[model samples]
Target: MAAVKLPTQRLYGTSFTCQISERNKDPPVGDEVWGTLVKEFSDVPDASAITRITVRLVIAAVLGGVLGFERESKGRSAGLRTHMLVAVGAALFVLGPLQSGMQIGDLSRVLQGVVQGIGFLGAGAIIIRSAQREVEGLTTAASIWATAAIGVMAGLGMEVTAVLSTAIVLVILAAVPHILPTPSETDSKSIGDD
Candidate 1:
């Protein structure tokens, strides 16, 4: 039986979705899991053609680098090198078992493992300034997750979708927040009435 490809299904059905992590025993934040799940598909690209390991690495690195460029431009912690490695490493990981024809417990487990692993990298991108009660880097971490997905898109030969998605992601990350009104502004009148 074939493994479920979460992002492909989710993307087609809904703009957003969520999943629970059995290991963590909690519902993971939807956006983060969605991004990582996309990255995990770096295994075979499509089932039709076998990919060369070297080519996979190049695609992962280059695709990751391009997405990472946008993150680095914003001075994110998980910039070029980190993004590049995550993608290339994921490609290598999925390729290993499949190329060898090893009977693994559904490909989805491999993908789940990828998500569990990337969580460590994502955690590092977040920073808490206890003194000032300020937190940062969540979006940067999300971007890293997204960069990995781009690599999978490249690995799978979905080049146009990958490129278009990357552009859309960049615009949303860079511009959307700036145009939206802050929650504080919307709630100010409520407080004044008290």
Candidate 2:
């Protein structure tokens, strides 16, 4: 008797399971495809001090969420939830080192690496569609970077600073746009218009 072939599993992120069947690879019979499927998975971290990590994640989420809320209110592409998740994830990543209480050299290097690493994400947020006709996401990109910073701060147990920074971020997000001048008009005219 022949053994049955098992479906392949694809892991997503770090805990979700995604099963891919052989049939899914079959070529489309017609120009119009019916049900295209893709598997997604993430690995959930298993640890004793899950609660502590969870707390850090939540704090980072809240900090990012605060900024995300501002963006959402303005109808930006990356909104509250996206920001929250990014911040929280970054915070948790930082917590691993912090909780272990590792060497000073390792910790310092990790800190620098974290800042440098977030740049990739920030870069993704910023895109110039055209040379003269540039469309920028400066605010959103900056918010993402700030969110990461807040996560690091939270991971370091700077809870008060995290919370205060979140609040200040919200306030600045709200007030800055209103006070800034429009690009179409001259500086004096723009201020006057405001």
Candidate 3:
């Protein structure tokens, strides 16, 4: 009995099993078709993957910048570059698992780590003005947290969600102060009455 040989090809550094009959000198039309399809679909060039990653990073950075710009306009210490870096870093954290082909469950762990890490950074932004009995930078810290979330959405390929979230954030940051008076303003109003 003649032993049948199977053709194999490498994809992403892994070989795919190809079954073909030995009776024919050439591979069957189906095998040839399959081989061509595999080469076309499975052999993604590294440059293409890099481009996708770069795009995601850029989207994350832009979304973060939008929020950062609003905070910077208010003269907050943690402004454009800080928010951009936070968003880019968070997106990369999510992207790492995706590029490695990690399962969703594993990806959740990475996301959890990203959130926890951002919490520490947000904490750094918060300051208690004990003499004035006031807390400052809370809004800036919250914006930082939200920027990270936008990055996560962008990295997960939810560009619409990221954009919408950023829009809502900008609206809140820009409009809320005008809608409600600040503590100092209220205090001054009361002092003027006295």
Candidate 4:
């Protein structure tokens, strides 16, 4: 009896024969694009995939900037650049793990690391004045944490969620302060009555 031959699949314009002997063979040389920084493990990304990645990164930065702008306008310590960096860093962290062939279960661990790392950065922004019984930079720290989350969403390809979250964060930063009294304001009011 004769064995039937199986069809081969083409990758990067090279035919990958499905023979058991060929399974361990390396991919053909000259198959990679010369200038791309990212190397695809399973398959090369076409122009569309590259464009999508670029778009996601840009969106992440812009959304982060929007939140950063709000913080900057309020004269916060962790302003535009800090927030933007956090977002971009978070996006890259997720993107790198994904591009490196990490499974979905493994990806969750990467995200957890991002959250925990961002928490440390956020903690650094906080200041407590014992004598004045005042806390500063809490809002800024919270914003930084939020910006990281926006970046994570962008990295996960959730563009709409990232954008909408940015808008909502901006609204909270801009409007909520006016609706609520600051610690100083409350203290002053109480002192004046006394």
List per-prediction Cα lDDT, in the order shown: 0.68, 0.71, 0.85, 0.82
Lowest lDDT 10-mer window, candidate 2? 35-44
| RMSD of model 4 against the true structure | 11.5
Compare candidates 1 and 3 on TM-score and give the better one. 3
Residues 1-194 of candidate 4: C-alpha lDDT, one tens digit per residue:
33445699989999976644443354544444532324434343677877877887898899899899888987888889998899989998988888778997989989999999999999998887667665778888889999999999998899999999998999888987788776577664222110
Arrange candidates, best lDDT first.
Answer: 3, 4, 2, 1
Candidate 2 local lDDT, 1-194, one digit each (tens): 33445555556745444554666655766522433221111123456466666677788887888899988888776788878877876776677776666765688778778778778777776656554455567677777778888888887778889998888877777887777665655433221111
* Cα shift from native, residue 89, model 3 (Å): 0.5
**Candidate 4 off by > 4 Å:** 1-44, 182-185, 188-194
List where candidate 1 sits over 4 angstroms from the true fold: 1-52, 102-105, 181-194
Query: Once model 4 is optimally superposed onto the true structure by TM-score, how far is the C-alpha of residue 82 displaced, in angstroms?
Result: 0.8
* Candidate 2 wrongly placed segments (more than 4 Å): 1-51, 131-135, 187-194
Q: Pick the candidate with the highest TM-score.
A: 4
Candidates in order: C-alpha RMSD to true structure: 25.0, 15.8, 12.5, 11.5
Task: Provide TM-scores for the models.
Answer: 0.59, 0.64, 0.72, 0.73
Clashing pairs in 4: none
